[model samples]
Target: MNWDKRYKQNDKPWDKGAATPVLCELLNIAPQYFHPNTTALVLGCGLGHDVAILHAAGMVTTGLDISETALQMAREAYPDLGETWLMDDLFNMNSNETHYDLIWEHTCYCAIPPKKRQDYVNSVFSLLKPGAYFIGVFFTDTGQPPQVGPPFSTTRDQVFHNFAKKFQLVWEGKPSQCYPGRENREWVMIWRKP
Candidate 1:
């Protein structure tokens, strides 16, 4: 389904209504690494709760989602966030070279079609500065086929293998707690551009 329709109908089950606790915990643990003023980009930012968190922390934050409706709702809900909400596809992000220090990949990988997974990795690599990082959660569905998704089931091995050429998997582990339904199935990954 188109993302615009999903937002218009409020069909985004992926909207956790707040920033992912794993991301919050990571930032807290390594505040010096991901401090305020870091240039950050959040892909598939949905209603932008995490973007708001980044903005409040004083980062130069930009949020990109394909849906204009979602971006509008994000702006309305967080009027004071001062985030740059861009209506653009992640695969086609025309960002300048080495533009971001951090790329926050919440649910964008699983949301994309399986055939385009390589493109997703390439886009992330293209947007980040060398040695910059991508930090966030991903779902792993054991034995599930690629066609079964939006919250597609992905394996940790798949993610590592996909990014190995361009990124080094620096940190990875399951979170202490995930949002209601996503208990033990999520993996929080931190990948650095090499």
Candidate 2:
């Protein structure tokens, strides 16, 4: 795949160049969404936007991606924002020493193939401590044609169907801030791992 090349060539359109308001608000205003004791794991954390936001808010954050190129760029760009950065696929990751309190799902969900979404959900459950939180921001409706991907489309029902059994639905809504074109098309979700 051209996943690594996308960053090497600077061809990433999915990066809004900053953390979403859902993340920022949780850190800055909505303390109800997360606890200070929580450690965060940010999946597909290309370039550390949300990583920085979480770290700055005093949460221990780890940024993981499948691309070494992307991880290098993230470390180089924002060394102070992330507590740890790893190059690993979410599906294959395991940490015997640590279980996170909050898992941040940003671009990773939509980037993977639709059929593997359950794998993503399972990974999240395995990595989190019980009763922890999963904060997901999904692109509910994509205006792009079916052939266009990297950002695949999914609905609220799909998300609920995948996560509801293992995770208790805490809150679901729209993000307070999104990229320039993603205003109404996004779904901001919070679920607690049961």
Candidate 3:
């Protein structure tokens, strides 16, 4: 998908204009899971809302996106946290560079083409420090055909197959809350790098 073009055209349907409801609820109910001053990276952080939420929770967060326009929008939306944004392809990030203590994923996994899902997992695994956490709110039942989309459909098995072996599963289940149409379609999972 031409993500930059989509952002340039303001065609982001996933741009919900606020932090994800599931993420907010997770942080609210389990603040102890996140340590203050720790580092975090938000993949496909379109408009920066979730990044802001992470920062507010005491994480030194960097919101990364493949689209410059999306990063621009994020900076405009949260000027005080302007420096928290980064523009780069998650898969292309140098594996030897700075690693993070936490990584947050929202729509990023679903947005990538299905063939690259394992690469996505590998890149995420490579980006974190040992014993760090990876928390994500994934679209497990998009109500679409498996062959269909940027917001592609995913199965429970696919999720576990890609991530469970390398990262120790800490928690997995339905999110406590979700966006209007997302009820029952999303799964919130937390994993720790072993």
Pick by lDDT: which candidate is best?
3
Please give the TM-score that candidate 1 achieves against the real structure. 0.93
Per-candidate clashes come to 0, 0, 0
Supply candidate 2's per-residue lDDT for 187.
94
The numbered model that scores best in TM-score is 3
How do the residues 1-194 of candidate 2 rate in per-residue lDDT, one tens digit apiece? 57899999988887777887668776666676556656999999988888888877777888988888888888888865544897888888765457998999887898998889999999999999998889999987788753467588888999999998789998898877777777899898899988
TM-score of 3: 0.97
Off by over 4 Å in 2: 81-83, 145-148
Candidate 3, 24-54: lDDT as tens digits:
8888787766788999999999999999989
Q: Kindly report which residue pairs in candidate 2 clash with one another.
A: none
> Model 1 over residues 168-191: C-alpha lDDT tens digits?
888899888677767788888889
Per-residue error at 176 for model 2, in Å?
Answer: 2.5
Q: Candidate 2: lDDT of 4? A: 94
Please give the TM-score that candidate 2 achieves against the real structure.
0.92
Could you arrange the candidates by TM-score from highest to lowest? 3, 1, 2
Over 4 Å off, model 1: 95-98, 142-145
Provide the lowest-lDDT 10-residue window in model 2.
29-38
TM-score per candidate: 0.93, 0.92, 0.97
